[model samples]
Target: MEAYRLLIADVYELAGLSRRTSEEMARAVGQTAARWHVLSVLSDAPRTVPSAARRLGLAPQSVQRVIGDLVDSGHVEAVDNPDHARSPLMRLTGQGRRALDELFARSEDDRAAVVDRAGVTAGELAAAREVLRKLAGALRTSVPHP
Candidate 1:
């Protein structure tokens, strides 16, 4: 049988590295992962805070905090939602777009480094991704929906 401990350790390390990288890049662009994610989501179209929270699987309060920070930083603007007068819609500002562009460039370079270090071919990575997707789907299917 495969060593579950080893798999868990690898997953933990990857998660840590991902978070660290996101934090470093986000700070360099004067934002956090939550803020970045919100801006990215609203880049194409405006969205309500609750919608953004659901997409990110975050608490509404947490998303609200990030949204407030983004608004204070002038990276996003909140406007009245036409569909729902009570709910406000958030949209990205030009500054947010510029920041996202810079972060994406850095992320691309970081991903390239990881791929080179892993020495895994594109085909191998694609196969692994497919397997992981199937596994995730199976797990989700096994769980009863609320």
Candidate 2:
């Protein structure tokens, strides 16, 4: 019980630290956290705003705003959706791919810094990732959805 309580506090701390570092990296790539997240989710495939929002666990309107900004910046493009006529699927453009690559490269140093600071072995980090995944799955079940 004490271990679980400590784990929860540690996870919250880690989440805050990660978000701050990620925001800095995103800013360097000319994106906000929301924009970066949207681009990342679309990296695999084009998705409607609603789909992207759901995956990101964000409001659709918020995601839509970020999507619009991405489009305006030519980082992403909207294509005709076969399934939905009104909502087009958003895909990354060549520039978007380049930006993502650049972002990753820029953030690599930050990631390394974190690992060095934590002094954690690769195996330990892997284990941490598995634990976090399990925690997320458990929490997802208790969260309400619209």
Candidate 3:
């Protein structure tokens, strides 16, 4: 399991960079990554909490908590879902869109720096992404949908 530990550690370190970057931006903008994700997901169109949760691969409660924060912060709004009266649809505000744009821009710069420092080529990154996608697909198929 030593090899798995090392691989997990490497992934954790890389993920840490993202978390740190997000924390810095969140402090500046006064919004957390969870909140940002909810807003970004709804930036394209309003979505029910369950749909957002599934899209994020997060538990519904976790997504709801973030959505509650966004709503409280005026970054998102909840409107009645015509299809489901019990569930409300979430939509991003203008401020949310601006925040997402800034975060994405900064993330792009950070990613480029990492790629340059690691001497990783675009093709290599693409291949890694493809492999991950296949792995995720296989896992999804293996899991039973409720």
The number of the candidate with the highest TM-score is 2
RMSD (Å) of each candidate, 1 decimal: 3.8, 2.5, 3.0
| TM-scores for all predictions | 0.71, 0.80, 0.76
lDDT of 1 at 50: 86
Query: How good is model 1 by TM-score?
Result: 0.71
lDDT of 2 by residue, 19-67 (tens): 7888988887677777777888999999999989988878999999999
Worst 10 residues of 2 by lDDT: 28-37
The residue-by-residue lDDT of candidate 3 on 1-146, one tens digit each, is: 79757765886797777778777776676667777677778878999988898777789999998888888877788888889999988888887788788777766777798799999999999997787677668878998654
| lDDT for position 90 in model 2 | 98
lDDT (Cα atoms) of all candidates against the true structure: 0.79, 0.88, 0.80
In model 3, the runs with Cα more than 4 Å from the true position are: 1-13, 80-83
Error of 3 at 6 (Å): 7.2
In the range 1-146, model 1's lDDT, one tens digit per residue, is 36746765776798678878888888886678767778777777899988887656568889899889888888888888989998899988898788878877878888888889989889998997787677657766786432
